[model samples]
Target chain A: MAADETAPAPRGKVTITEIARRAGVSVPTVSRVVNGRSDVSPATRARVEDLLRLHGYRKRSAALPSRAALLDLVFNDLDSPWAVEIIRGVEEAAHAAGAGTVVSAIHGRSGDAGEWMRNLRARASDGVILVTSALEPPLHEQLRILGVPLVVVDPMGSPAFDTPTIGAANWSGGLAATEHLLSLGHRRIGLIAGPPRLLCSRARFDGYRAALEAAGVAIDASLVVPGDFHPESGFTGCNTLLDLPEPPTALFAASDQMALGAIEALRRRGLRVPEDMSVVGFDDLPEVRWSAPPLTTIRQPLADMGQLAVRTVLRLARGERPDSPRVELGTELVVRASTAPPAPVL
Target chain B: MAADETAPAPRGKVTITEIARRAGVSVPTVSRVVNGRSDVSPATRARVEDLLRLHGYRKRSAALPSRAALLDLVFNDLDSPWAVEIIRGVEEAAHAAGAGTVVSAIHGRSGDAGEWMRNLRARASDGVILVTSALEPPLHEQLRILGVPLVVVDPMGSPAFDTPTIGAANWSGGLAATEHLLSLGHRRIGLIAGPPRLLCSRARFDGYRAALEAAGVAIDASLVVPGDFHPESGFTGCNTLLDLPEPPTALFAASDQMALGAIEALRRRGLRVPEDMSVVGFDDLPEVRWSAPPLTTIRQPLADMGQLAVRTVLRLARGERPDSPRVELGTELVVRASTAPPAPVL
Candidate 1:
């Protein structure tokens, strides 16, 4: 041991041998007490524990108990507002369930699958709730091997694992959004689709096509544009669509944040929402309601989804198989001041 | 074991005895390999490690590794924009340091001190960079008991412990904000303060008082309103001040979020910012820059604070006592379009 406390030491890892020496006990006895070995007598156990505390000797890593008491609340990205709301919901339920959450960021799009997998393997959480669907194949496979009770939220594609999943009826919500514009007598409707890789985007696109077909309006591929489900992407996508020779009379964005951006783009070009271009959005977050014109959007049961995810994971961790392996929660369309009948073509 | 696997069947936890029996070794030999005790052969060590993985026999409650290969970036509130930016900064630094983060939120102001204590006692983190003031007595005492290498950010009132801390130059920031208002020729300026228990708030308030005294302006006790560092509190506090018979011509909020809320409250009463009353805020968060009229704010070195906090905690965890127990960083005043000369008295 060095006398210079402030000196840059190579490393200061305290070992069990040091604790045993300080406690005046055999290494085996110290191990027994640390591991709570039933064979150790009560008197010796107390003495060893006291000594361990005095020397700041923590429990050895190898003696970890088999049962997990903490829960892992996995989010696809830490920066997204949608994830924030869902996390708050999950946190509330987890608190009520007497479980602590270990938050891990799983970057879905950056191709950083190895980093996320390594984290999942290194951190020992009791159970896991996957809150995003954009996880790459390798990371998803790694999670499967993890063998913990798992729950998936808003899963993008088909059910890949035996674990339970909870998600909103995204397709129905898309239909409602498109139908609202159609009911407003807007025959030429354009859609801002989410990333092509995401299942939610595919479903929403399907619903959009279905709505147009049902209304006897020709489905124009040119009216659909791809977006990355971000505000900036929405703004860019809206600008591209609006640049067409005969642009859509109405626009439907898959997310509210994107819709807000679309409004900004429209305003920048001196166009008013609904008056010049009608817009409808999905996921009516609080900020959407506060937007200038108050966005017309679809509302998902985010809080309920969070509660369901936690409950499902807890049930699986407790060795109880839930009745439903896949849950599709409902969504509702909220009409506000953001949408109106398409302006008469001049 | 029971045959029924689906109905909450108890799979008795695998113990060291079972591992020894399966490996065909004595209990002491099994213990030696599991604990990485000296004198264990390589083959025996590998066999024990393989079995441990196969059985998923993790310790129920084990302290984090003494020499952590990763960092734990802890924050009191996860939803705040300021905290999020700081976390992003920590994430970038930790990535550069070849370390990972385990983000855990300690719900402050919700009055859940017991939960905070439990998480601290669990010792799930290697090193803690507390992005909050440990002014609460119970939490302060618990920090002493846990004794993990720690760093406090923006610690208020008194030093919670001898651990290193890093925070913005709150006193200077406060003075800058106040001086900006004074330069705008606003003599009747109101202050929206953070919690009194927090040292940052006290320093900012001291700066506010000093600026007024230095300018030969009399301090009006009635104009000073205290609030929790929350937007809602700011809204309420602003309403109270605005309702006073002799209202101030300007407002200086201690936080940007608070300043935004104050602006909203002022708008509700048909008062325009800078035109009717000037407003100055602290912390130039992204939202502040985009806010209507753009905010004139004091910018704290958020990213720097986060990086320093992580580095200091890691050093302390490695048994190096830092020379300075507290480190005060600096802040800059950013003059945007929010402040202007006050309107003449009605």
Candidate 2:
């Protein structure tokens, strides 16, 4: 059963069962010997060992038992300061763990996925953190078989399959945002909704509806304008709501970028914030603090989500399973100058 | 004198002349054979060929003659939207070229240089685009010797070595920014500068001073508060200027970020932009267009700089020298709502 030095054998093609069949031994015996478990008899161990070496079969742990040197970070786009904040958190975590990071923008796979995947494998990245879980299943399987760890942040569409994820309590964030406006005596509140396809978007939207339902306020379709969580979308959404016969007295944008856009739209129409309309935004990005009138926002721990993703993926890379499949961090309400009580009735 | 397979033969270490000596041929004969240049006798060619193969000596073209698949982008830091604009431009250009990009932030080295350099080598990046030219000489030589192409954007200190570089007309940008503020009929103008070590900062500062001198206004050191090109710095600079016994009626910030900071500082102190004081900024970042009152600033064509850097580095990777060692694109002043004639004296 001695193996030839140059047998031209390759791994990843043959499974443990196949090896067991070839060796005329049980699958457990083959596995035991391959893992150096030592429970197998000497004769069987030698036979299985020779077969394993000849076939170039190596367990996932055997290929890279040590920690990986670099982490792969994939994003839907790199256009927003939101991405920068996430990058900052991930970089900080990666730095602390003594690992380097590589960032890729897939943009819904516009054929960039093939190139990015090739580079990831070539780089032998220790793990991967995908900011948006808008990926095809086949690609997920491909990465799984290659033994590269993966973690998702703010999954889009539906929940990903068995992939650990880290995200903010977006529903709670939405609820708290609406409640803040309600406490300030805002009954006629308008909402700029995020993308409908994303689960986080739906959760936040649902939470907003729940708050209104609890307040005994009737749902007004005209007050809810759809947006893509961008400035232009927010601007358009706000303008649409403002054009209504009886416009909302207070507006809640799903994102800070969108809120800023809404503010711009309001100003262009010769309206003032708080005095004319109160606005509250989500994701309390740093730039929002410098926005005119400042910004009252729901603070989603975007950086924490990034840091948590790194930690989760690193754990997976170390061959350890995460404690939970999904981890939701808390959100906070930051009241600044953008929000105020509705103007006194004329 | 033929090399043995296990002779510890370093591929890049041995010289062609050494191969010639071993092959019993003239230096010219060896050179011609290695370069695949004809006109060498078959007998000599056969001898030199055998020696070349034995020693593992191959031309540079023999290795990765194809264009690289990944481009490395290094930044001093990635905290600014300015970086995002540049990234957008480079990513677009790189996508067009079917090349992938990897971004890194050095934070003034922080000992991350070794990790970054190692990653670059392992990935065999086709080229490198450095946002700042503050790299150490040894690291520069290492990249050059490894045949990795390099380009610099907005060189921080000065023009780098033979490496091709892309930069903005920073002096013109500065002059234009200050000139806009001066045109508003303001004699005492505050200046918030960027990092002093960067060449771009020095140029802009010089331009601001020149604009004042040209207007026959004496410079006031107290009115010129130094800043590090961030929002907080701008806020502090504006506050410091506001505290001066003789305050300026207008301000010119070195970057859009600083301008935003100045606006925030003004708003926090119960002041209004343009109505209270005119303001001008350099680097018309995308966010600046959405800033309240928009912004009147110099447009640096940051995205174009990114695109040009990729084209330049790709050319270098193709073994072609650029038309010039340094290329400075133009900067234009964009008149937005932020600048207005100073309020009539009380």
Candidate 3:
């Protein structure tokens, strides 16, 4: 029973009456202050000013033009620790840029895609930074149509979107991990790769394979187990790898959470890290450094990536074309107590 | 540029086309399924049934009542690791009750209250769980008027609104902390209290004072320092306390983060934990247990509190009076390696 009805829309204006009510002041005094009638005392004026500052109340009729503000942040998952750090970075940058951020968590579930589309349709934000794996076809199409300043973090997009991307050198980090194991004289090594759906996962896997091939080692498919970038999944993957006909002496996990899980699984099986099976993880989250025995992992420049992503998004929002649409931050092999020469075969 | 426009609203009759589109099926297939037409293949029927199960799509024209849905979980901040465990508990309980969650972070500058209000107004969540320390008067009043199921976590409301609250026994926890130090033969005890604006802070302070009074120890105003529940604040507070002429032998920090900060400050000043100054912390967050030498703290039943909050909110949303409006979970003293008898001051 929808029917056309005309009603005078309320103007987006703040009145003296509303301010006085908000500040718990008299309407007459508020009017006098607003109209510059000068009847209000200094204390009253200061109180009103404080109230205005607290509520972000600006006179709608003010002649000054304000800059249009919007921010887009890409997050791996709502629960992911990496996303938390990135969010902090993006938040700080957005606040400095005088804009607001719209965060979206990308998951493997298709329902999230539909929700993402709805969010895009609403145009709730000015630009988007796709944070997950490379954009899926449907999401990329929708984002392109929205036609805002776009930046992809941790995912290098296809030519269709041609947006700037910021990510770490995952492949090189993977190589460094494998090379470390090779230097430790480990003939058999296990690789716990992230989800196949993500390009970073594939890149890291490629690096692992390349390192193995360079060392003249046969790529044993059984040594490579698929993981979901979660600690639970890592534990399961480690168990599966450990139960193999011939288990590897060293393990390279694609994520710190997965590595921690691997360590737990190892411990449960009466295996000590480094002494039994050395492990190296990626992304070096804060907990990784503090984990029992401390994990030796590849350190992706997460904080730097976050700061750069924010700076890039800010530039895009300001109609400034960045010199490069793609940014590949560096990663270092943080040799900690977790990794050592593979122990002699029992 | 605003215009009054209305389109013909869909009627009460559940259209087969609408159901099929929503379920991603053909109209004739939906019609056959609805009418129990004999010509429909078993596979098509099963697919439609599965779709119906997934989307909760029902024939509105039929005299079937709609099932209740999940409630919204409005958290103040999500970055805190403590919030993660709480959320997991809430999520598990809510899922068991056939409810979903919509999480929102509401910590912007004080001026963005109106923006937060607008965001909350646009949300379609059934109820809200406010996991924050302090609620602004205006925002709180507005949320109360929404007439939805509301449960507050941590913050106890003023007598004006009788919304249910679930939290740890903060006061008792504080008393326990002080008593532990007292039992260890420490008369000079210092307190690092949380922000004064928080209800928990006041309750904890009261408990601390009560415990000292019970032990025939005079409360030293100079030994009390204000902390904002952050590690940095804890460090500063500890420094301030340590600088006093008659420094406290044992210190009780209101939160784990602050405790860690205090520990850092102590270590920086070349003092060892428990050896030079005994330390006790509240909220045994995961990292605290893994810190160097670990920390002795009060362990709040975070997960249980989360689950109870979710269940309570769900019941309220169903127009059912919860068995209890207030849930005060207990806190246990986890005597880790952080605290010991004060070293014999020669």
Candidate 4:
């Protein structure tokens, strides 16, 4: 370390000019690296990156390059309507911010991250809003080195401590859904839990357990079944609970898709929703309201979370600290026709 | 017009240098006008635009401006699952081609077009795919002047004949749906038509009439009702049909959302689908498969259309003529549980 140079350096927020001065390069060279151009040498790129990290340099909101402002939104897959809701939210908010939204689905968790990264580097995106957890650690570091602002929506696990994240109140949503069922006088409530790997899913499961314990109802290990948050898993989970020696009268699915699946499963067994069995779902997606027996659900503000992600990322891009780095939007329980009092015990 | 300069102009695509020479301006000035940069004087912009339009200047597939390749997808509104399906398709195809997709909803037909246009001008988008007919002729002309490639998906009314468009076989879908009901021994089939303003909707309605004619079933005008292709309209249309002195045995809704609405209306009236009144829908959106008595409907190749739009726009951007200026993909009838032989006349 150059002690004299370090002593003269500002305490925080170094500019490209200062970085270039320290790296013995021109201002344009620093600009090229900052803009993610391919012309920089590997050694120089490394040195600049080290200094950038050391100084925590954040590019101030200078006049953007001649190109349009773009916000990249990445997802693991775009197959579900859930993804659509988030896209709508992000698109709306990004548009409001005078930024175009670039949407990408990386197929699976991590397989296409490299391709996406290459594309990201190729484009001068203003910021990145990650709606999926597929990107690995090195990519995150690369983004940081590039000085790109990032906001994660519904982060799967413990993201970097400083990474700003937006998510629904999964735990509270789960608890409220279960509590709604309990209030309807159902003691034996089947729990269709989302994938255990996801933090949101785990939080929801914890909420379900908390609700059950709060009501002084014994947790029946046999009644809880795991799901991957798809309708197929929900169907399978519902059947698993139904085949048990003692079946719960009402069931709560961690996702609307799963709830729809569970309802279909019950239908196949010649049972009626709310009559033969009561069902509750999470993520009150639009179509669920028109669902047969109209689903009772926990409404995750998916679009709001998406909108907030864009706002937070833009704030970071402007070199402003957000009031909260991690925000969990409140979730609410919506009672429709799906849940009802348990049928008179035989 | 500069006659002496015009004499030597190329007969086909003009280069930016040639345009600059003809316009008596710097190459960068003409380039700015082409790139939608607002810095150029209005008078200079008009002169450059006229020369470019006269010469049919197309930005050749040279190295793009060092920004990410982006294909803009615009819709009147992003409220429907139909939009989501299309978005998924476009996003997938754009990803495959190493291009990013920028999605925007103009809100209504034309309310937000100016804002979108401003954003579009501020960005270096490679191509545009219009999913709505909202953008007016002036905007279209502006996009043309900017040399941005354009494609239309499910265009409403008659778009400019030169504009390449992608759509589903709406007439065939409608014909097939109505014929299926006729084959199911139901002579009285209600038709829930989409807004007549859209050409696709008109085509579907025409096919419905043609099917009835082919079956020698006099089309009862009273049985057909107009809808805005929403669930609420479908519900209202279904109720209207049911109140007739002689109600139809089955109904075909123009879109899946309307079909869901119709089903909900029936549920409210305590009428079971298929057993009481058979129902069919258009646009077999993904979630409809999980709908109660899973909707039997015509499946519009929405995603396929979206994918084709991306390919077509990219091709136009490359200055290649597509095989067809207007292409309609086939729509197939998916026979699920919603349609069955109408219950024996009581």
Candidate 5:
């Protein structure tokens, strides 16, 4: 729906009355949508939401009573240890702030949005921290109407300019990992890349390319295989790269799980890590150090990111602007037994 | 405080008036404590709680409004991947039941009880599922006063008789793991035991002894090592075993993490798994299957136990008695590349 009236207030300062007038809805109807009441019809709710977004209306700070004493942490899925690390950080921070933390998983399925929204309303959570989940406009609009502060951790795509986001320096991490392998006299390096849809994944891949260019090594497109940041994909991707006419002497995986999976694949082929093929991985998860060949990977501060997200969202809930909208923590290279000079050619 | 009257109604059927009179507090004061209000003095709160427990007070079925749409999941600490597996199950089950899950970590500190109780009251959660956290009497009394349903998962010790609990057949799992080693012709086996405080740990240790007794083999105290169910202990324990004049041919660790640590220690000693010394672990965690030697472990249905705990607590929240107050799921032995017949004497 388009605005009915001429330009009124500046973006993010429009009044609720103007929004309702533009949407052709009664003030109470707009109020019902804001309160997450079920009495409003879907069509009117959608139209009102559109007007709210179109006008960039912002709820006045301190408009409502003190927010609920609970914070919500949303995820696409809760199957990985990576998530657990984040949860630990969020839980600790929230507890320290005297707020309970409600965790919800949307399962990345089509119908999960409605269920998730309902749960959000039911809990009346004060703030939200979404980890690597999409931020569709409709969902954003609903959250805005409820005046719930939100922060994104490792956002799936580029987050809204105004939304606070916390992420690791994936590009620099990828570059450092690839450079480490190159410094060890490895010219032919295969890459197991994460899904291209994620901005972080893209950055990592670009960093890999940039590192290769800096080293004067020709980029072999066939050596780079696609992965979903999961072990299974890593396994298959490694196998695919291994079958090439001339395989890479070393490998870099975008994630530690993928690196482990690649190692497994090499083992099946009767090859050993570092001795037969060197490997580097990102996200130095806790258990990687204990892996047969201690993993040499990038150390992404996952728990710290989670903790920062909670603190940022809580600050926003208190009507305070964060120092910055986006924060990228540094990643470090941890040298372990996984990387070594390529074995002498027979 | 003991009940004042000689005999009132049967246990769990006492009236609020009686409890107030017994505790020498006003009716509204008792109500405040019951509803988790902060107005009641700490001394009064404790007194009222004792009386409530003494009379075995039970809130009538359907007395409260349809309970809050949130369930609390508390853990002593959320450090291990094992906790993540349980969390996944609880989150899934709670979501399916249209309830949000609030996760809290008490960190197993001395003063965490008050903080945890405050968080629980703030959320007004409908039920609680405590995972491997001590259920001290004072904390139990507070929960009882609030009338919140509770289910214990992997209780640290034997759970209170009336409290519903979900656990695996630890003793049987331990027995089966030991027997597997024996059947593989490993006459001399070492044991890496978990903490002595937990009932599950004690049972596993007992099972190991039972297996050896059944096989007509004498227990060797020197072959047993104590571990806190962590990798560090396992590493040190393995080193201790290797220092023995005659180290056992096979080893069984009480937990998967401990088993992985033992493997690392053996690796440092230039010993190969199964070929040099066979190893078996408990809790077939997901990552174990991808470990260097693909660990042979006892599968302890951790996720299933978590799911069952949520279901049981929800049932109790609805004022329905569960099928049983305690449930122990079965465990199975998973043979991977980590175990084999003991190597013949050189």
Candidate 6:
């Protein structure tokens, strides 16, 4: 210890909870002040610092279970049925843990990173659960210095070595959707795939390829088109596929929204779903069950993924490692009216 | 002044900003301590009070602008496309105003109200915007005492006299939808309506009735069915209509989800949307545009409603009343492929 610095108490002696109780602020605030975050009001920071000094506060020698009273749940966007399911699951998990959740969104605009960090510092959230957003290295370093726990859901890019992540088995899901179509005797199947850059999207595309090879069917480049995982992309992809010399009899879209768009394209041509073209969708969202011909889809356990993310984040917040650094939930085939044997003539 | 209470310097003077700046605390924290909220740490609250004494802070007789750096947005539930549109709108408005928004949900659980109120006080939000939830008198009283401005979006029930509210011209929308079907040579139109408890639902049902009466069509009680503004209700309502001795050739649903359900019901019965039975829906939600036969529906400016709520709340927070206590934005009729001349048979 420096001459002017008092020695920290014995390792594992003073917990964050005790310091927070004495400082008259939330535990996260104490963590923020200790990390030297600048957003905290000066007087509030000074009060928390005094308590830290009096207790001889020091960094934990090892990760230890320290429960937080709150967690922050952030989404890249909240416009889709996909995001709603995830939010519900997180809320349920948080409620069970008796912890409150603060919901936020970072649209990736300029200065959004700074604004988001400032808010997190102000709230002193115990842990952060980010859904479908890239994890930047600078952010990781800042959070590491603050000793804040972070877990990503369906991470956009390859996550850092230490970051825990939760996602569905997209490869299996894609293969299953394609195999179902093959079983329906549709050799010429079209794929409306999500953005090729996303890892999950690439996994799914690979799975589709594997299914074709397993069935001894030749993969045709003309049958596959890229979609941005939205309705318009699906519509445009389907239109592009229809323009091909030999349009596929069955279409498997990487997302439910895309499938709906494909259905719309077929409808415009006055062709009936299943009667003319068999369609399979991924992510059996709530809306699909009520679609004109209830859509057959690969059901990603989205809510389950969300629930697991919350549990993992809570564990991390308590200074414990998750049972696994990467967890992949299962996906299943949900057969509905949208898929069937292709028309004999086609 | 009481012996323990330091005498205030003057009447109608020191602003919340000056007190917050001098005390090195947030304006909301000062507001919370001033209102005797229990959530703040005692030590921090005491320090704030000492500064309040030194500055001789006094309540102003004039409505002074006390800007809260944060705003709170509470949703009755976060599960619907309806809610998402509103959230995006509020976010856009908040972003434009350069204020941070804190999103919350009150699922009508017993303690949710108390918990939400506490979080709001802790954050010291400048204003609160609630969507489709009734305002309880006690909460109203508490917010009023704290001088926090509040605005409701599509209020479920009659609001407190002072609370500003924004909604669409739902009755006009309902009337327009029914009239559009009637103009297409349909006499007996089936109506799938929302819950009776909600004011907006009642207005829409009444609109449907007014259009029928204006056209000299009898108000057949059997033609109108109550739905809960969801898919299942629409399905059930359509089934009920189909069971009637004479199911109407044209159907109008109070919401897009319900309309989708009605279409699904029609498809299950071996019917084509506009060819076998014409269907019209309200709320031109983004999903409906891509529905099998694009739906002709009434468009409620939901995003506009959200934006208006934020603007209204901010105005109130600054101690200004909105131009009107009840602001109803206009609804428009959007023609699409779903409606056409009714099939030649009943």
Alpha-carbon RMSD of each model = 15.8, 9.3, 20.1, 4.4, 6.5, 7.7
lDDT of 3 by residue, B1-346 (tens): 6442232123222355666776578887886765446887888776665544333233332211232243555556655667756665666575555444444455645565565555444332456777864557667655544435678888644424677888789999999999999998999999999988787888788888999999999999999999988777888999999999999999999988788788878866878787899999998876565454568999988878888998887776555678887778998899977788888868
Please compute and give the TM-score of the first chain of candidate 1 against the native first chain: 0.76
Please give the ranking of all candidate structures by DockQ, highest first, separated by commas: 4, 5, 2, 6, 1, 3
Q: Order of candidates by lDDT, top first?
A: 4, 5, 6, 2, 1, 3
Model 3 alpha-carbon drift over 4 Å, by segment:
A1-168, A171-346, B1-70, B156-159
**Local error of candidate 5 at residue B303 (angstroms):** 1.0
> How many clashes in each structure?
8, 0, 1, 0, 0, 0
Indicate which candidate wins on DockQ. 4
**Fraction of native Cα-Cα interface contacts (under 8 Å, chains A and B) also present in model 6:** 0.37
Q: How accurate locally is residue A103 in candidate 3, as Cα lDDT from 0 to 100?
A: 52
Clashing pairs in 4: none
Better by TM-score, candidate 6 or 4: 4
Q: What is candidate 6's local distance difference test score?
A: 0.80
Off by over 4 Å in 6: A1-70, A96-100, B1-68
In angstroms, the error of model 5 at A184 is 1.5
> Model 4: DockQ against the native?
0.52
Model 5 chain A weakest 10-residue run by lDDT: A59-68
Compute the lDDT for candidate 4: 0.86
lDDT tens per residue, model 2, B204-287: 999888888898989888888889988889989999999988788899999888899999889878788889988888888777
**DockQ each:** 0.11, 0.25, 0.03, 0.52, 0.38, 0.24
TM-score of candidate 4 versus the correct structure, residues matched by position? 0.91
TM-score of every model versus the real structure? 0.68, 0.79, 0.54, 0.91, 0.86, 0.82
Error in Å for residue A11 of model 5: 19
Q: What does candidate 2's lDDT look like per residue over A139-254, in tens digits?
A: 78656655577889988755547898888899999999999899999999999999998888888888889999999998898899999988998899999999999999999999
DockQ of 3: 0.03
Which digits, one per residue and each the tens of the lDDT, describe model 4 over residues A136-255? 889988888876788899999979647898888999998999999999999999999988889988999999999999999999999999999889999899999999999999999999
Q: On lDDT, who's better, 1 or 6?
A: 6
Candidate whose lDDT is highest: 4
